[model samples]
Target: MSTFKAPKGTYDLIPPVSETFLAVREALAAPLRRAGYGYVETPGFESVELFARGVGESTDIVTKEMYAFTTKGGDELALRPEGTASVLRAALEANLHKAGNLPVKLWYSGSYYRYERPQKGRYRHFSQVGAEAIGAEDPALDAELIILAVDAYKSLGLRTFRLLLNSLGDKECRPVYRAALQDFLRGLDLDDDTRRRIDINPLRVLDDKREAVQKQLTGAPMMRDHLCEACKTYHEQVRELLTAAGVEFEDDPKLVRGLDYYTRTTFEFVHDGLGSQSAVGGGGRYDGLSEMIGGPELPSVGWALGVDRTVLALEAEGVELHVPASTQVFTVALGEEARRTLFGVVTELRRAGVPTDFAFGGKGLKNAMKSANRSGARYAIVAGERDLAEGGVQLKDLQSGEQAPVALGEIVAELRRKLV
Candidate 1:
C-alpha cells in the first residue's frame, strides 16, 4: 500500500461529511445576505506585514502561528491565519469605504493557515465563515454583529453555545488600565514570558488560562473600572441594545482577545459541549486596525465562526442537519436501446431544472435498481426496451417501492409533482 496520509493538524472534508460544512456556509450566508451584507473574497496570502502590523507582533498568531515566507520574487508573504486583517486590507485597497457606503458590510468564507501544535478543534489549516463591518463605529453596530452571529448559530439549530462579551476599552482609556494592570501583575510571581507580555500587552495577562495565574490575578484591575466616560457609556449602550434585542451574554471582565487591533467591544462564542477547544468563534471592534495596517483610518467590527468546531458543536448536541441527499432523479437504463433513448430524456430533464444522474456501462435491472437505491434519490426513472418502445418510462418511488408507467413527455412533470 502507498504510505500517504493527510498532513498532521489538517483534515479533508470529504464525501457525505462535507455536506455538513456546506450546510454551515449556507446557513451563515443566508443571514448575512438578509441583513444586507455583501459577499467578499480576498487572496489566500498577503504581505507578511499585513498580519505583523494588523494582528499584533506580540500576539501568538503573528509571533508563532503565522505561515510566513519569502517568495521567489523576494516578496515577504504569509498565508492568512485569520480573516479580519485581510478582509479589512482588501476594503482599504479597493477604496470600498469611500464609495459612499458607511460601514461597508461584507461576509467571507475561506480556509486559513497557521502553524501550531495540533489539538482538538485546533489545526494548521481551518475553514471559517467571517463577516466584517467597516467604516462605522456605533454601539448598535457592535450589538448587531453579535446578534448576527447568534442568529446564525440558532438558525443552524445549535443550542449549546454561549456569548461572552466584554469591552477592552478604546485607545483613549486602555493605556490607563494597562498601567494599573501592569502594576498589579508585577507584584505577582510570573515567568519571563508573562512578564514580557505585561510590558507589550498587560491586558493579555488576564487571558492566562493557568490555574496559578488565575489565582494570583483575581484582585488585579479590571478594564471595566478604568474605561473612559465615553467608552463606559458606549459599553452600557451596547449591553442595553443586546438585551433589548433578546441577545443574552455574560459579562467577562477577563476577555482580552488574542489580537491587538480589537478595541472596546469584544466577544467570544463558546460551546459547552466541545471541551478544551470550546470557542466556536469570536471577534470584536477594531477602530485602529486600518491605521495599524497603513491604510486610511477606518473603524471596523467583525467575527469569524469556525466551521470545523461548529460541526462538532452540532454533533455534541445530537443535532443532525438534514442535508439534501439527492439533487434530482436518477435514471436507470435497463437495455442498450433504453440507455440511448433515456439519454435524451435525461438531458431534457436537466434543461428543465431537474438535476438528474444516470448509470453508465451495462448493468442488469436488479443491479441498476441497487445503484438507484444507493443514490439516495427519492424516485428512480426505470426504462427498458419494452417501456421505451411504448413511448413511456417506469417511475419507481425508491422510498415506497411503488411504480407507475408515465408517458415520456410527462416525466419532468411527474417527477416534479412527486418531489414537491
Candidate 2:
C-alpha cells in the first residue's frame, strides 16, 4: 500500500461539519448584504509587489509570512496573505472609484494563506468572510463597518467576544509620533532584526509580542496621546456612533493593528475562549492604502471574519448551528421495472425542489429499508414489482412507521406538500 496524506497545514472539510462552515459564512455575510454591500470575488493569488507596497515592508505578513513564488512567466506573485489589500487592488483595477458613489461597498469570502506554525486557532490555510467599504473616510463609515461586524457575530449567536478599538493617527500627526517612538526604541537593547525594523517601520515595534520587548515598551509613546486634532475628533466620533448604535467597545491604546495602511480608527473582535490566538475578526480605516498601492487616494474600512476561528469560538461556547440535513426523502426500489419508474419519480421530485435520494445496486427489501432509515430522511418512497403493477407507491413515514399508498402520478405532489 502507498502512504498518502493531506498537506500538513490543511484539512479537507467533509460531511455534516462542512455544512456548519457554509452556514457560518452565510450568517457572517448576511448583514453586509442587507446594508448594500455587493458581493466581490478576487483571485487566490496576486502580485507580490501589491502586498509589499500595501501591507507594509516591515510587517510579518510581507517580510516573513507570505507564500511568495516566481511563476513560469517570471512574474513574482504570492497567495494573498490577507483580504483588504487584494480587495482594494480589485476595486482600483475595476475603477469603482470613478463610479461617483462615495463608498463602494463589497463583501468577499475565501481562503487566505500564511506560513505560520499550525496551532489551535492559527493555520497555514484558513477561510475568511470579509467586507470592504471604499472611497469614504467619514467616521460614520468606520462605525458602519464596526456595526456590521458586530451584527455578524451576534447573528451567529457569538456572545463571548469583545471589541477592542484604537486610533492610529493619519498623515497629520503620525510622523511626529513615529519620530519620538523611534528615538525611544533606539535606546533599548534590541536584536539586529528588530533594530532594522525600527528604521523601516517604527509602529511595528509596538505590535511586538515578546515579553522582553513589551517590558521595555511600557514607556513607549502612545498614539492616543499624540493624535492630531482631526484624528482625535475622528476617533471620538467613531466611539460616540458605536455607543449610540449600542455596540460596546473597550479603548485599547496598544491596538495599533498589524497593517501599515491602517489609519484613524482600528478595532478587533476577540474571543477570550480561544486562548493566545483570540482575534475572531477585525479591520480598520485605511485612508492611504489606495495611493500606497498606486491607486488614487481612496479611503476604506473593512474586516475579515475568520471562519475556522469562529467555528472554534462556537465550540468553545457550546453553540451548535442549525444546518438542515442533505436528504429529505429516500427512495427504495426493488426489481428492474420498479427501479426504472422510481428513478423518474426521484428526478421529478428533485426538480420540484425536493432533496431526494434513491437506493442503488438493487438491494433487497431489508437492506434497502435499513439504508433508507440511516439517511435521516423524513419519509421513504418504497416501491416493488407488486406496487408498480398496481400503479401505486408506498410512502412510508420513517419516524412514525406509518405507510400509505399513493397513485404513481401523485407521489411528487404528496411529498412536496408534506415536506413543505
Candidate 3:
C-alpha cells in the first residue's frame, strides 16, 4: 500500500472530474471577463495583519479559521482564508484606484485555506473564482455583479440557488444602529463571548448560527429599520435596478455577512439542496475595507463562489456538466513502421489543436484496439504496413464503427474537418 496520503480535509482532482471542475471555473469567469474584469493573481499567503484588519477581528474567519504563523524572521503571516482582502491589498499596493478608472474591475481564481472542521460541503483547502469592482459605489455596479453571478450559475445549468440581499447601512446610520444594537444586546441573557462581540462588532451577532445566540437575536434591531436616508435611497436603487434587469432576490434584514467590511449592500447565494452548508457563494459592498487596511478610501464589491461546494450543489440537483472527451483521436499502429508513421500523425494532429493519443508499444492489435476504446476517443487512426505502402491510413469512427481510408498526406486535414 502507498504510505503517503492526501492531507486531511483535502482531495485530488483527476481525469474526467477535473475536466468538469475546469469547465465550471471557466464558465464562472467568462461573464466577468466579457464585462471588463481583468484577471489578478496574488500570493497564497500575506501578512497576518492584512486579513486581521481587512476582514473583521470579530469574524469567525479571523478569530477561528485563519491559518496564521510566525516565520523565522519573526514576521507574522497567514494563508489567505478569503480572496477579497488579498485582491484589495494588491490593488492598493499597485495604486489601481489612481489609474483614473472609476472602477478598477478584476477577477481571480485560486485556492483559499482555513482551519475549520471539514464537512461534506466545506473543506480546509477549497477553490474559489471571485471578482471585484473597486473605486465606484453605484447601484448599477451592484446589480451587474449580482446579474453576472446569476448568469454564471445559469450557464452551469444550476436551477435551485437563491440570492439573499440586504443593506448594512453605511457610516451615516450604522453608528446609530450599532449603539442601539449594543444597548439591546447588553440587556440580553448571554455569555461573555457574545457580550464581548457587542463591544467589538455588533453586526456579527446576527450571523451567529448557534441556536441560543440566534434565539437571543430574535428581537435584535434589524438593519433595514436603521437605514439612513442616503442608504435607503441607495438600497432602493439597487432593488429597482435588479427588478428592471429581471433578477430576483429576497430581502433579508438579518443577513449580516461573515465580514465587518460589508456596508450599504450585502448578499449571499444559497442553495436549498445543500442542507446546513447552504451558501454556495456570497459577498457585499466593502466600502470601508480600503480605509480599514490603511489604504485610501475605495469602495468595492465582489463575490467568491466555492468551486467544490458548487460541484456538490450540482450533484445535489443531479446535473452533470457536458465535458467533452479528453482524447479526441486515438492512434493504434499495427507494426514498427506503422508505429513511426502513426506517432508522427499523432504529433501532427495534436499540434493542430486536436486532443490526440497514440499507442506507444508494439502491442497486439486486439490489446491496442481495447486501449483506444478506453481512451474515450471519438475516432481512431489505424495504419498497417500494407496501408502505408498504399499511401493511405484507415480512419475509424469509434462512435459509429465506420471505417474509411484517407490518403496519408490528407489524413490530418481530413481528421481536422471531421473533428471540428
Per-candidate TM-scores read: 0.98, 0.97, 0.98
lDDT of 3 by residue, 247-351 (tens): 889999989878888998899999999999999999989999999999988888999998998998999999999898889999989888898888999999999
Give per-residue lDDT, candidate 2, residue 147. Answer: 95
What candidate 2 gets wrong by more than 4 Å, as runs, is: none
- Model 1: CA > 4 A from native: 1-3
Q: What is the C-alpha RMSD of each candidate to the true structure, in Å?
A: 1.2, 1.4, 1.2
Clashing pairs in 1: none
- Give the alpha carbon lDDT tens digit for every residue of 47-163 in model 2: 999999999978999988999999999999999999999998999999998987879999999999999888888998999999999998899999998999899889889998999
Better of 1 and 2 by TM-score: 1
**Alpha-carbon lDDT of model 2:** 0.92
Kindly provide the TM-score of model 1 when superposed on the true structure, using C-alpha atoms.
0.98
List of clashing residue pairs for candidate 3: none
Candidate 2 vs 3: which has more TM-score:
3
